[model samples]
Target chain A: MKFSRKTLGIPYGVFLTLFVVAPMIVLFYYAFTNGQGVFTLRNLTDFFTDPNTLGTLFYSLAIALTTTVVCLLIAYPVAYILATSKLKAKSVIIMIFVTPMWINFSLRITALKEILTLIEGNLAYYPFLNSVLGMTYDFLPFMILPIYNTIVKLDHSLTEAARDLGANERGAFLKVTVPLSLPGVVSGISMVFLPAMTNYVVLDMLYNSTYIMGSLIGSYFAAYNWHGGSMIALVLLGIICVFTLLTDSGEDDARTGGALL
Target chain B: MKKFRRILVPVLVLLFLYVPILMLALYSFTDSTQIGAIRSFTFKNYETLFTTDELRSMIVGTLLLALGSAVLATLLGTLGAVGAFYSKKRTSSIMSTVNQIPVINADVVTGFSLCILLVVVFGIPKDTYIPLVIGHVTLCAPFVYLSVIPKLKQMDPALYEAALDLGAKPRTALMKVVIPQILSGMVTGFMLAITLSLDDYFIATYTKPATFDTISTYVVNATKGSQTDIKTALWALSTLIFVLVIVLVLVMNLNSKKREQKEAKA
Candidate 1:
């Protein structure tokens, strides 16, 4: 007996539609409806109007943005050095940075929490700071990996060409290397920022507070406030979609710029 | 100055990464009752962890979920990848885009939304391993799908055609010629799925039954109100996991290197 490739894809299509697409539909249904299942926009309105909820959204965005910036500042230099260095054990060193990831991140964060406590004595007094540090620590590798991948795959002659064109080392790096690596930086920012926005474990572990969008959703779910939780999640889904679209447009710009070059 | 910085920066970053983990590992061996104070070195944390009921169940439950999800995801995903590879171009493109939803969506949203589906929409009871496994499979299968599709693209089209021309059945041609070509991708996908599933906390937390607990959720629960003993036991578990991973990675690297050398000689 023979089976067509389209037939082979049927099982997967069914699985995806049932599990992924259907569940999302359910999420939206819950987001818009009240306890009686009547359609309503109150959930959405309540989310935007509630000061605490709005504050949590702001906090989530602020912290995620800061974490992205910190990760970029730290990771760019590290990834640059790793990519350009003549070190013999470069792969081994890169592996070192990656291996900690295999260890459960929550465990790493817990270890970090312990160290922070020992250093400062009162992490509670600095919840935002601790959460930022934890977010940066937890996500720095994510930022590094994408940027490293791009930098390593970069055309060496691009830099050489810039230098050949009478550009100094600093100018060559700033003009050529930075532009070429923008895609990776953009991707790294998206990866880090999206997760950091929803990462309640780091916040909960560091601050024991539900101050971010993720923590807020988690608390609502924990309390069986399904309507509230789903609404927040839907809003987050919209935000993430817009965020990805913006970053993806930047990537398109980079691609066009590279093509022009 | 440049030479000094190249070494110094990496060393500093590495220290930042490893110091806490090493310290935690060190603390795991010590009798640390208070949060920051280690009094004496001992193996009691491990001993207690090994004997405890809740911790034992948590470990078993975690492994069960990880393994079950990894295996199921790999099977479904490999099939999906194969299907995608041979399907029409337009259909394949659409499938691939839809598949990335879970990968890009926030973990919190995925977990919460799925929880809604299982509990409210489907009316499945909350807090069972079934939902957790299903949730994890959903999370992991996409990774396998993405990984395997690339290998399939890279495979030689002639191999399968040749097998078919040699009078092999379609299934035989697929199993014999195509599967072997994509075995590495499948293996990579399986490993990736396991790692992703094992490290997950958010999806597991929302999807899991109240009685069930993965290592992540257990640690989170223990850390609530700062249960020192449970936290230390987790550190011991972390040390064990860290050592196992290091050993496994090293062995894999060595084996691959040996294989490469053999290939070069041939």
Candidate 2:
């Protein structure tokens, strides 16, 4: 009897069906159903109509946006410096920056909360600032690693050729290096943005704030409102799907010679 | 001046990254009940960490869970990668796309939905640790699949065929020829799975038994309450974990560097 290689995937396929696919189906079912389990679109309408939910959604978006921008701003320069620098032991330095991720993040956030309280006398006073700061601190390494990997693998000769073709240093960097590194930038943005939108732990530790989308879902589940919680989860899943599609298409466009100068 | 700027920027960022961790390490050794004040220099926190039964049990339980979940994820992930690598293009593409769902989805959603599916719908009791393990494996297996697929791509596609042509059984060919080539990728995937399990808070919070706690869940809950002794001891645990990770990563990096140098010489 011949053993087919295709049989090897059966266990994983079964696992995925039971865990990933079914849970998503269950989420959709609950989202469209009320407590009595009757099918209704009330959850959807309620999500959009409730001013508090709408406020939380938009506020979460704004916070996620701020965190991603701040992380990119800090991480790009750091990654660029580490990748392009001629210094020996640069990998060790990069390792130092990334190693904090291994420590349980709650502990680090707790430590950061202490430092903030010392400086401001009260973390509750600066909820937004502290939230962004904590998130930027947490997600900076995610942004740095991908960008560094991309930038380091970039062909140096391309930039040199641009310089040879009468392009100045700034022009070569802007036209060649930046455009070539967009894949990394986009990936970094996606990695940081979605998590920042949902990592209510940061807000919880730093500000005791629960206005974010993640904690909103938590509060719903805590109140035994599975229907409401599932709806929010479904909405978040939709946002993630759309965001992923947009970024993916953007990457495809960049790859097909759509470099912007 | 340009060189100075390059060095200065990374240095500043590194300071930003390390300061909080260093602060935590510093506070761990002191007798201070909080971060701002240093009442006395002592090793009391470290003592508390090892001596407390609850802390010890939680730490041990977390490590055991990480190991168990990582092992399961690696098996499923490697098998999926191998099967997909050998399958038809359409089937492989579908598998890959389905695999990406968990990777791209938020952890909060994944945890919540898993809780609903297994506990609420399927009627699995949460205390059995079944749902927790399944949740982690689901979170981790997609990543393992991703890492292993690249390794499969890098391997010589003809090697397996040659083994079979030489009269090796299909299982033999896979175990002897294919698995050896992807061992490094499997190891990487296993390590990643462990870290993901250890770092997870949301999934564990949603699915873990009411009496049990991983370090992540324990830290979140412990910090909320005013258990100053347990909270302070966590600082010690954090310091220890930080040191352990530093040593592990540095040694791995050095070994890889050595391997690269040997390859260059050869």
TM-score of each: 0.95, 0.96
Q: Per-residue error at A143 for model 1, in Å?
A: 1.1
lDDT of 1 by residue, B114-195 (tens): 8888877778886556678878988988888877887898999999899989999888899999899999878877887888
**Candidate 2 on B1-266: residue-level lDDT in tens?**
99899879988898888887888899899988767785788999999999999999999999999999999999999999998888899988888888888888999999999999999999899999999999999988988887788789999989999999999999999999999999987887788889889999999988999999999888888878888998889989989998998898888888989998999999
Q: Pick the candidate with the highest lDDT.
A: 2
lDDT of 2 at B91: 85
How well is each residue in A1-261 modelled by candidate 1, as lDDT tens digits?
A: 367655777777777887788888999999899999999999999999999999989989999989989889988999899989888767666777767777888888888998999998888888888888998888887777777778888999999999999999999999999999988898788878988899989988886575788988888987998888889999999999999788874442222122111
As a whole number from 0 to 100, the lDDT of residue B255 in candidate 2 is 90
Tens-digit lDDT track for model 2 on A1-261? 468999898888888888999999999999999989899999999999999999999989989999999999999999888888887987777777778777788878878877888789988887999999999988888888777877888999999999999999999989998899888899888888999999998888886575889998899978878999999999999999999997873332221111110
Clashing pairs in 2: none
**Which regions of candidate 2 are displaced past 4 Å?**
A249-261
Off by over 4 Å in 1: A208-210, A249-261, B34-38
